[model samples]
Target: MAPWGSAGKTTPRFLGQFSHYLFRYATWLPVLIAFNSYVAQVTWIRGPSMYPFLNPQYNESLRKDLCLVSKWSPHRNLERGMIVVFRSPENPHVTVVKRIVALEGDVVRTKPPYPYEHAKVDVGHVWVEGDGDKTKDSNYYGPVSTGLITGRITHILTPLDRAGRVRWWEHAEREGVQKAQAS
Candidate 1:
């Protein structure tokens, strides 16, 4: 009997397959994990919050927008009009995407559902809002700490017609918020 298996010269079939699986995964898993954690990630944007831009439609055909979220920006200062994905303050377990409407030290006249008529963004925090109304965002939760930000949406990669680079202040002219992102 061979030391590697049953009363035979060959290694067990299950053992060989298991080793191969481990070898394949062990060799690439760490690299994949690092790349996703520090570089960028692709995600499907769901819901109508950023309407006509991300997940445009709500009915059948239901084709959601696929986006590239750049993880590199969270360490730097974020500016107004940039779309961002962050941990929901109301529920840390969930993440939501919204645009920065007011930055720290900036004052904004907020709309209803947001208890106050005006809000001054405190240091280390920023005001965010969805392009679409009725979204559950800072307008509802108030300013969120910059520490909660996870990544910035840098591009839309799907639905061919809408695929392109997403500039920081591309939607600034759409209203509710109008400050252009500084270069």
Candidate 2:
């Protein structure tokens, strides 16, 4: 057999190894992509909006919760009561986490002490609020665009149950519209 024939057989083994590595990398590619551009895994709750449910400032003993926020679905099909992370409309560099109170084409009317002036949520936009009434949310800043939304909270890491996934109903107790009207 010619020397070239011997090299031909060796090429297959190299290619096989390369293919195996590619397969392994493919599995993590989505995660890597999310980590790199779409989702952020580590976040700090700066304010008390999350309140007793998340950050307990009064106790100073209760552990704070860190969560993963996925910006991938912000514009797709965001539903009410979902925990979302978005940029502050007044300031793009700042990020905030709040619950979706209303969506596009919805009328948002809140009472005094809060100034929205009976705003109408526009298309490609959403209304967000903190569970804590004291928080500065849509009541203060008004409706924000879907483009401003970065992601949804998928998991919470803190206290006893670390890596706990955040569910929809866990934050659905408050009625956004009703609360707005009541305010």
Candidate 3:
């Protein structure tokens, strides 16, 4: 007998058992990938633009905020002050998060670089701005094409106490965002 007595027999038995479970899980891999790609995904918030909301404790810490981004309906209706993640028009290589400040046809009060004092949001376009006002947003760049928005932020999943579903309507009202009328 070996030092562990059943060492030789246990090794082969363990290998056989592990392979069985591995094959069972293998069948579920594609299903998991599909769900992650189409239903929802977890994302990390990395900037100060959405401060005191997302990444609230990120100033000097390594603990960034994690949230759930809903991709269930790629073209779901969006309302003002609702947060979303989209491909950065300036740099397609990066993604950004911002709140919708104005919808199509709504007149927006322009900031410094946008030229005019007020401009109407073009059809299928939206004005997005960062909460912190320190980051580049619609006020810096022109309106974003709605097609670029990838997902709506639906929940915060980190920092323990703040983990829960976000209140989209309340945020919109608090920011004094005018509601989007159905076209």
Q: Give the Cα lDDT of each candidate.
A: 0.80, 0.71, 0.80
Best by TM-score: 1
Counted clashes in each candidate structure? 0, 3, 0
lDDT of 1 by residue, 1-183 (tens): 323324233868787667766776787988988888678989988888887567777556778889999988684868778899999999999889998888787777887888988887887888988888648887789999999998999999998887899977656443444332333
Error of 1 at 29 (Å): 2.1
lDDT of 1 at 33: 80
TM-scores, one per candidate: 0.84, 0.69, 0.78
Task: Mark the regions of model 1 whose C-alpha exceeds 4 Å error after superposition.
Answer: 1-10, 173-183
User: Which whole-number lDDT from 0 to 100 does residue 152 have in model 3?
Assistant: 86
In candidate 3, stretches whose alpha carbon ends up further than 4 angstroms from where it belongs are 1-30, 172-183
**How does candidate 1 fare on TM-score?**
0.84
Error of 2 at 54 (Å): 2.0
**Shift of residue 57 alpha carbon in model 3, Å:** 2.3
Candidate 3 per-residue C-alpha lDDT over 1-183 given as tens digits, one digit per residue, 9 for 90 to 100: 223333345568777666666776887999888887688989989989988778776678889888999977755688877998899999998999998888898777777777777877888899888777567888788899998988889999987899999887787343333444664
lDDT of candidate 2 over 1-183, digit per residue (tens): 333323344568777567666776788988887674564657767677867556756347545677767656567778777888888988898888888888777676664556555767877778888877567888787788888877888777765554587776656554435332322
Ordering by TM-score: 1, 3, 2
Which model, 1 or 2, shows the larger TM-score?
A: 1
